[model samples]
Target: MRRAMTDQLSGRLVEGGHRLDVRVYFEDTDFSGVVYHARYLHFLERGRTDFLRLHGIGHRALMDGAFGEPMAFAVRRMEIEFLRPARIDDVLQVETRTALLGGARVVLDQRILRDGEVLVEAAVKVAVISPDGRPRRMPPAVAERLGAPAS
Candidate 1:
C-alpha cells in the first residue's frame, strides 16, 4: 500500500497529535504470546519521542542548549491502562497528544490501538529539568512551540 511505503521508521504529526505505526515483534511478547505489560511503556515512549521529533524538538539539541540552558524532558508520572492484548505481528498505532503544556510541565495522552481498537492508554506527565536534575521552567519559545493549539 502507498501509505505503508512512506516513513517506515517513524510516524508523522497529525492534526492534533502524532500517530506511529508499530509492528509487534517476537521480543515484545511473553511466553503466552501476548505482549508483555511492560512493553507497552516502550511503545508509549516511542510515540512521545517521535511526537516531539516531528514537532522540531530533539533530545540532543535540548542537551546542547538549543532552547536556552541545557535541559531535558523527564517523566514525572504515568498512569497506564492495558485494555487488551496484542499478539506478535499485529500492527499497532500509537497515538500521542498534548493534554496540557505550560510552564515546566506537560501532560500527554497516549493510546495504543490495534485495528482501531484501543489496546492500551496512558496519561503521562513530564517535567522540564536541568542537567543537574533540578526542575526548570521550559524556555518560552520552546513552550510556545509545543504549547501551540493543534489545528
Candidate 2:
C-alpha cells in the first residue's frame, strides 16, 4: 500500500526557514506566458501558512479557538519586488522566515526563487486579530512556536 502523505510532504523545514515547492501552471501565467505578478503572492502565502502549520499551528485550529480564542493572522502590509519573470512549467521554491515577532504582529521575509535565483521577494507584516477583527496579542504558545525554527 502507498503510504499516506502528510503535510511534511508539501513542504519541509530548512535551516533558517521553510521551503515549499510551487509549480507554475497555465492558470498561474499571464498572456505573455509568464507567471502573473499577483500569483507570486499566493505562493508566498502558502509558504507562510505551511510554515505555521509545521510549527504546530493551523488556520483551522486557530479559527476554532484552539489557542483559547478564535483568531487569525491578517496581512497588515506587504512590500514586493519583482526581480524576474518565471515561465510556465517552471518549478519555484517559496521560502518563508519569521523576521520579527511582536505582541500583536509578526514580520515575515519571503522569497520566490527559481534554481537559486530570486524571482520575487517580499516583506510581509501580519497582525493577529480576534474573530471580531480587533488586534490581539499572540498567544504565548503561538508566539514561542513561531519564534523558533521548526525541528
Candidate 3:
C-alpha cells in the first residue's frame, strides 16, 4: 500500500520535539565540500514546517484562508551558531522544539546534528501574519493542537 503524503514527508514527534532527517547533496555543499552556511537554514526550515504538519497544521491551509484570511509565518529574527561542518553525502538530523508561543509569535530552538554530534544551533522567532503582512494571532484550535497556550 502506498503511504500517505503526510506520512512520507512528515517527521516524527519525539519527546515533545520533532526530528527530521536530511541528506546533504552535492548542490548543498560549497567549494570546500562542506555544507553551505545558508543551506543549513533550509534544513532547519524544513524541520520546523514538518513539525507543524505533524500536529495537523499546514502551510497550504493557512495560505488558503483556513482561518478567515490567508495567513503565513514570517521569520522575525534568528540567531544561528555554526559549530561543526557537514560534508557532502552526510545524513543529518534536525531537531526542533517550541520554546515559546505567544498570541502572534512563536520561538523555536533548532539544532542540526550528525551521528549525535551537534553541527549547528539556532533560535528562531516567527510571527504569524495575514497575506497583507500585518501581524495576526494564531487560531485557538491551532494553538491548542500545537500544545501552545491560546491568547
Question: Which lDDT values do the candidates have, in the order given?
Answer: 0.89, 0.90, 0.89
2 against 3, candidate with superior TM-score? 2
RMSD to native for every prediction?
3.5, 2.8, 2.1
Worst 10-residue lDDT window for candidate 1 reads 1-10
Over 4 Å off, model 2: 1-4, 148-151
Best by TM-score: 2
In order of appearance, the predictions have TM-scores of 0.92, 0.93, 0.92
Error of 3 at 123 (Å): 0.5
Query: Clashes in model 2: which pairs?
Result: none
**lDDT of each residue in 12-41, candidate 1, tens digit only:** 888889999999999999998899999999
Poorest 10 consecutive residues by lDDT, candidate 3: 142-151
Q: Is candidate 1 or candidate 2 better by TM-score?
A: 2
Per-residue CA lDDT of model 3 for 1-151, tens digit only, reads 3457666667689987899999999999999899999999999999999998887778998899876678898999999999999999999999998888888888889999999999999999999999999999988776676674332
TM-score attained by model 2: 0.93
Tell me the spans in candidate 1 whose CA falls farther than 4 Å from its real position. Answer: 1-8, 148-151
